[model samples]
Target: MQYRMLSDQRKRWVDCLRGFCMMAILLFHTEIYYTGTSIIGYNLYVSDALYLFFMLSGYLLYKKAGMIDIKYKLKSVLRNLLWPYFIFTSVMAVPKALAHGERVDNAWALVQNVVTGQASWFIAALIVAEIFFVVALRLCRGNLFALGSVCVLSFCCSALLALNGNLVTFWQFGNALQAMLFLFLGYVFHRYEHKLVVDVWPTV
Candidate 1:
C-alpha cells in the first residue's frame, strides 16, 4: 500500500474543521433564536460557519471534477438540489397563497418565489453556486487564477449591487456571489495545503 503524507494531513485537518463547524452551527442555532445575544463571541463566529461549509464543499467538488464525469455531477446536483427545491417550495407556496386570498394556480408566482428565494433560499444559492462553479471549471480548464479572478469580480459586483438593495434583489444574488467567493477560497486552500499550516489556540 502506498501512503501520501500531505494528502492524509489535509484530509484529517479538513475533517476536524468540518466537525468544529458542525458543532458551532448546532450551538448557534440552539441559542441564536432564544437568547438574542452572543455567547462568549460565538455569535461573531456563527455567521462564518455557513460560508466555511460552502467553501469546504467547493474544495472537495473541484478535486472530484478532475476525477469524474462533469456532466453526471451536474445532473446529480440538479436532481438532488433544484428538483427538491422546486417541489417543496411549490407545495408550500400554493397553500400559503390560498390562505392569503391569492390565486391558487399561479405558475409565475411560484417561479417568482423560486427566483426571489422565498423557498429554501440557502439551498437555491448553493445550487446556483455549484452549477456556476462546475461550468466555470470546465471553461477555465481548472485554471485557479482565472477562477479566482471571477470570484473576485463576483464579490465586487455583489458589493456594488448590495448598495442599492431597494432596487436590486441584492440579498439573493449577494449571497450567491459570497458563496462562490468562499467556494473559490476553499479550492485555493486545498490546492496549496502543502504550504499552509493551520493553528488553533485555547480561549482563556
Candidate 2:
C-alpha cells in the first residue's frame, strides 16, 4: 500500500539521518580530542551538530507531546533522562573524581556536577527547557504575539548574561533560550504543516 511505502521511506530517511549525525559527532569529538581546534574544511555546518540536534529534538518532542498525554510524556522524559544521568555520573565520573583526589563521594559529586552543569549537563538543561516550553505554551495559549515577546525576552536575557559573566555558573541558560526558539519553530511548523511546504527540499 501507499501508506506502507511512505512509512518505509520515512524509516529509511530517519535511519540515514541518525547514522549521519552519529558519524558527524564522532568525527567532531575525535578532532577536538586531537587538534583542539578547527574542523578542517566545512567548519561551520559540520561543527554545529548540537544546533541540528536541538532543533530535531524540539520538532520531534513537540509533535509527540501533541499526540500523547503530557503527564505520561513528562514521566517518560524524566525516567529516560535521570536514570542515565545518575548511572553515567556515578559509574563514569566517580572514578575520575576519585583519581583527582576530590574530597567528594560519588553521590555528592554527581549532585554538584549536575547542579554546576559539568556532568551530563545537556540533559538537565533540556529538561528545564522542556518545562519552559510547556509553561510558555500554556501561558501564551495560542497567542503568537505573546509567545514571540517571551522568546524575545528570553533571548535578550541570554545575550545579557553572555555579555556579563558574573555569577554565571551555567551556560545552559542561554542554551535554554536557543532551545525554546527552536521548539517554538517546531510547534509552529507542526501547527501550520498543511499551509507550509513539506517536501524533500522545503520552501521557507
Candidate 3:
C-alpha cells in the first residue's frame, strides 16, 4: 500500500453517512407509507439534506472507469437484484394470492409476478436507479460533463413532468424517479467533490 488516505477510513465514513441517510429515508418512507399523507415532519427536511450529501458520496465513490464494458456492468448491477427479488416473491406470493381470492395454492403464479418485475417494481426501481448514471456514463464514455448533462436534463424533465406526472415512461411506478434522481446526484457529487468538502466548513 504505497498511499491511500480515504481508503483506510472509507468504511468508517461510508457507514456514518449511510446510517444517517438510511434514517432519513426511513423517516420519509414511514410517514408516507403508513399515513398515506404528504405530511412532512422534521425527517423530511433531514431526508432532503441527506440526499444532498449522498450526491457528494456518489461523486467521491464513482471514479471514471477507463474501459467499462456496458454489457457486463448492466448484467452485474441487475444481478444484485435477483436473489432479493426471488425472496420477496416467495414471501409475498401467498398473501397476494389470498387477497386476490384466487387459488392461493398456485406457486407458479406468485413466482411469475416476482420474476416479471410486477410485484417488486420498487426494488427493481431502486436497483436500476442507482445504475442509471453508471449505464449512462458507459454510453457517454465516462465523460463527466456528459454525465452531468444527463443529470441536469433528468432534473428538468422531472420538474416539467411533475405537473402532469404521466408523460414519462414508468413514472407510475411509485418512487422510481426519485431513486434515479439520487443516482444522478451521485454523478454530480463524484464530479464535484473537491468543491463540496473544501467549502463544507470554510477554512479560517
Query: Lowest-scoring 10 consecutive residues by lDDT in candidate 2?
Result: 195-204
Cα TM-score of candidate 1:
0.68
Clash counts per candidate, in order, are 0, 0, 2
How does residue 162 of candidate 1 score in lDDT?
Answer: 70
Sorted on TM-score, best first, the list reads 2, 1, 3
Q: lDDT scores for all predictions? A: 0.71, 0.63, 0.60
Lowest lDDT sum, 10 consecutive residues, model 3, at 167-176
Q: 1-204 in candidate 2: lDDT tens per residue? A: 976875566456556665676678778657765776546554555536555555556555554334434576678767886667667765767665655556554577567776565675556667666767767766777576787688668767767877886324473666677567766665665566446443652221
Q: Listing every candidate in turn, what is its Cα RMSD in Å to the true structure after a full C-alpha superposition? A: 5.4, 4.2, 5.4
Instruction: State the displacement of the C-alpha of residue 185, model 1, in Å, after optimal TM-score superposition.
Output: 1.2
lDDT of 2: 0.63
Q: Kindly give the stretch of ten consecutive residues in candidate 1 with the minimal lDDT sum.
A: 195-204
